[model samples]
Target chain A: MRSRALALPMAAVLALSACTGALSDTGSLLGRDTLRIGVKADQPGLGLRGPSGEFTGFDVDVALDIAERLGVEPADVEFVEVTSAEREEALREGRVDMVVATYSITPARKTEVTFAGPYYVAHQDILVRADERSIDDVRDLAGRRLCQGEGSNSATRVIGERGVAARLIEAPTYSECVTMLEEGEVDAVSTDDLILAGFLLRSRDAFRIVNAPFTDEKYGVGVAEGDLSGCEAVNRAITDMYQDGTAEALLRMWFGDTGLDLVTSVPQFEGCS
Target chain B: MTAEAPPRPDRPTARSRAAERARRAAGRTTVRVWTLTAACLVGIAVLFAVTTGAIAQARDGFQVIGHGAGPKVAATADLYFALSDMDAQVANVLLMGDEHDLGAGREEALRRYEQRRDDADSALLHAAQLAEGDDAEQENVRAVLDGLGDYEQLVAEARLLNDEAGGGAGQPPAAVVDRYREATDLMRLELLPKAYNLTLESGATVRATYEDRRSATRLGPVWVALSGAAAAGALIALQLYLSARFRRRYNPALVVATAGVVGLVGLATLMLDDQAQQLRTAKEDGLDSVLALSRARAISTNMNADQSRWLLDPERADTYAQGFLEDAQTVLYVEDAAGEVPGDLAGYGAEVDDAVTERGGYRGRMLGFLGEEVRDAPLAGQAAAQQEVLRAYDGFLRADRDMRLIAESGREREAVSAHMGGAGSVEDAFDRYEEALIELTDLHRDTFDEAVRAGDDGAAGWDVLLPAACLAFAVLVLAGVRPRLAEYR
Candidate 1:
């Protein structure tokens, strides 16, 4: 009787256990031979979808490098589309094995998901139409209709703390805001300088960065929360890529011809510390 | 009177008496038949008039309310939003500099702007469709469309000049600002006023629909009542004549026919009453809200243009500033002929007043940054320029509180970055002040969309419901009179 009673409880416990999926643990990426990465599909040089339905961008290159570090082949890595708002949720829900979509590293975000190396620093800058002369700098943007990517704090910080009098419009993605600027829907689009440069590369002679950069944004790889081992592994890959001149090579390959501020060395890692 | 007496039965002369009796019976039959025919014919005529008149009234009402008022109001709102959206897009395009051939984000902005232009085009088409036959209305809509295209071209020219002047330069040339000013002036003085006039014309159209609906319903009941009363009077007269001639209590056929006419009159009146009341409610709540919201939106757009003009033309800064104040007064306060504040908004009204004062404080600070001697003329008799320069420098010195004290300040990029939010820079501070003014404009805009939506919802199903009611009354009149006509048969 006791054995039968124990069997019933055991079956019940087993059923409960079967219903719950496991969280991604530290260094667990290697267990699966194929890696799934969430990337921005619209950021031109950072992470973008090209013709022939292929993903190509600097962020794609970095993800390929990290996958190679994990002993996974570049062809085996699948890229999932992630928007700015969905990045954190996508990581928590196991929608992606990792993310390398020009994700910014922040101390507050560290509490939700672990960040690996900050491979790049993109300063906050403004993108205006080719014909705008009233706005020479951030100050000239006063009362202008300036659009920013939704969920980005670049415009918010300027409006909140700096007191820039710009009229802020939020779009779902950087691409939409960029389109608005190109068509003259909004006055300026403000975000990372390098991201804007990527836009400039895509749209010829229609736009340029007007004012100097205002804030520094460090880009990092996003992993599951508390996955320190996975974060560390990605950081190691970044470090090796830098040491072997591969990181600089990729940077030159993607942005050397553009007006972006190119860097030869890897950015100082945020370390998730 | 009893003039002749009949002969006795079963006599040879009784044949003559039989003939006289037969002739008298025939005469009585003829009288009864003619009276019944007259009553029935009059009843049928009145019923026909009531049904056809009601139907005609409903048709006219529906044509005005459904095809004219409803769609025209929607068209006006679309035009207003489209113009406002286009103006904002122009500003946005100017802000994003030369984002072609390699620029990503600004190009996205350009696409968004094109989408807005498409929206405006669609709105124009819709307005044209609403006003299909009227030459004046069509001409007016075309004017707005042409004006919009011109405005876009001007904006493009401005963008081109601004891009050429950029050339990786430190500041944009004065010519760039001038081009932007021209574009803005086109929007404000020419394009915006045309849009406003279109809205007013649409408002007039909307008013006509309501007036037509009201007048249509008003006359319908009176005609129904008048025709009904005449039919009843004819039937009653027939009844009295029949009662006297035949010595009967009442004619059942004529009574039923009279009651049918009365029923039709009541039904038409009731239906008309419901229609008029509902139509009135829709007009007051729905159409009035649209008018108020349109006015509010025009004010906000005007303010936006004024602000842009102020930044683009330093020489006309004071003029633009005064214009902003006047527009702000109109937007914030509901004034009468003498410019007296009428507290129509109750508690929500205070926000405008507060925003105005807040804007004033920021404007004072910003005008100084723009080198307003009136604002930044720090107490100096012979040294106004010296004191103002010293004060500006001091403000910058205190600006970068947490920033590192310039480790060999030769890097132009880093120095600019470090001084972005610095104290004495006053750049960000000016932005803060401008933000408040924008907030003031936003407060007015937020309520406009809701008003339009509420008005639209309230006005729904009016045309169908009213016409359906009229048809129902017609059926009720036909049903009530059919039984009376059958009794006559």
Candidate 2:
């Protein structure tokens, strides 16, 4: 009688496991040899798609390293361009196995899709023209035209929580924002320092970051909800990426020239549900 | 006679009085004939002035629309083509990368780019001259010039950066790509649009002139006929009155004048009819074809540039790919055709070609540059020339498909090699297509020139003949009436 009762619970657990595995976006990715990871195409050093028809930068390297850890070859990894707005939808629709597109881990986002790691803790900073000196801190952005990238909430952080009454000017991408800033159309560009660092690499002396960071934007790898196994797998990969010094090397290679305090350690991972 | 009037003391005799009355009546008849003849002469002169003025105006209308603004607008289309080609060459040079000795070589590409720049500059100067009177056109020209300056600056920056960071074929530095993106964006968004607008503005002028002038010429015959009839009727009335009052069968001079007026009216009507026909031919066949073909050439050139951009910038490969398809459709469109791949072009071209030749199954349905060309193939050899152009364009589309397939199959280097290959390259195919288009344009241009010439020829000698005929008619009328008046004396 006890043996029969034990078998019933085991069968129930097995069925539940099967159901989770089938529904999990990350679980499906684990089974496949080829993995499609969403990334940013326009960012210069973070996840830029280069002229060689290849994706290059810090995020790309991390994605490849994670894929390698997941037993998928680098060649088997396909990078799809994903913007801030489409990250969650891309994961839910199975358009991407996971998005390493500078996605931030937030409580609201965690409700929609599971997040793997904080992989890199980026600070929100302000970018302005090199010659401009009147405004330095985030507070000084008041009444100035601040470029807001489409689908990015960086503009809200300045005006909403910070109470800065800065005027928001929208652009399709951060690259376009930089373009606007270069042409004097926008007074400043506010985003993650890493993204700004990428733009600074190309412009040389045309722009500079204010270094006054406010808000800790913990970049995360997003997976479909209920994909606990997949999320755990990604977490393990993130840990390996840091322990093996691959993360540090990638960060240094892409953002070394840009004057930012490079974080060289594993970030605090958001626990998988 | 003695019973008629028993004379008063003042009257000498009844016969003498009757003779006086008869002489007064004859003198009055001569005066009436002279007055009517003078009035007929004035009416003939009026007809001469109106008919001659209409002919001269028709001739001038043909010159202005057919030769002046019409050709100038077509020349601005060359400017559009040149600007597109300049960007294409820039992309080509960048695609060459560290490999300076490709099929055409970077040096040759740069040289072509410079040549196109010069051509564009000259075209701009010509456009400015054409847009002299209209403030809006002048402003558009100025805007294009400013945008061109910005575009050139960005291109120079891209080239400098690419040269500094020399890499393999089809792999430019990130910074170079960024600069090129800016430059190409500005060219596409600002300069090209403004240049096309210049053409559009000038084309509008030609169209307005054509409508106004053609309408005038169309009604010229009717007005000339009405006035001529009035003049002829007056002459006939004068002749009838003379015959009745003077008891003569005919006045030879007056009869000749009436025949001259009728003949002049008939000739003027025929000339005016011919002028209207010439104007229609010039506008519908000549200028219309030139504009459409110019647009086609420019669009095709830009489409080829999109191919190079696709090969060079892989990040936006799909975007460029989409652009290529859209441009292809613009050049030669087929309904419900989703040209996702290069192979799809052949079917689309075939469908369009079938519609072009059948002219019945799908007549008026096929739409685009090539569609319009086939629809209105009015010239002697124009239909055959349009078919040749379609064939050449099909060849180019095929080559483009092959290149794109190679690129898509992960053989980018081979694709680039094939693209830069001299003989069987996309560029070569496009050049042949351009050749065919030019030939067609030349045929239409000839027609335009010929129509204008015919318009001038039709109105020839009317200016002097009209006044001379009027003078002759007047003298004939006076001569016929002078004898009657001399009878009174």
For TM-score, the strongest prediction is: 2
Instruction: Assess the local accuracy of residue A210 in candidate 2 as a C-alpha lDDT between 0 and 100.
Output: 83
Over B58-92, each residue of candidate 2 has an lDDT whose tens digit, in order, gives 88787787667777888887898999999999998
Q: List the residue pairs that clash in candidate 2.
A: none
Residues A151-195, candidate 2: write the lDDT tens digits: 877888788755799999999888899999999999999999998
Task: Give the TM-score of each candidate.
Answer: 0.43, 0.62
Residue A166 CA displacement from its true place in model 1, Å: 34
Fnat for model 2?
0.00
Name the top lDDT candidate.
2
lDDT of 1 by residue, B390-436 (tens): 33322322332211233124342232333232343323432343443
Against the true structure, what is model 2's DockQ?
Answer: 0.01
Give the runs in model 2 whose Cα sits over 4 Å from its true position: A1-273, B1-17, B336-364
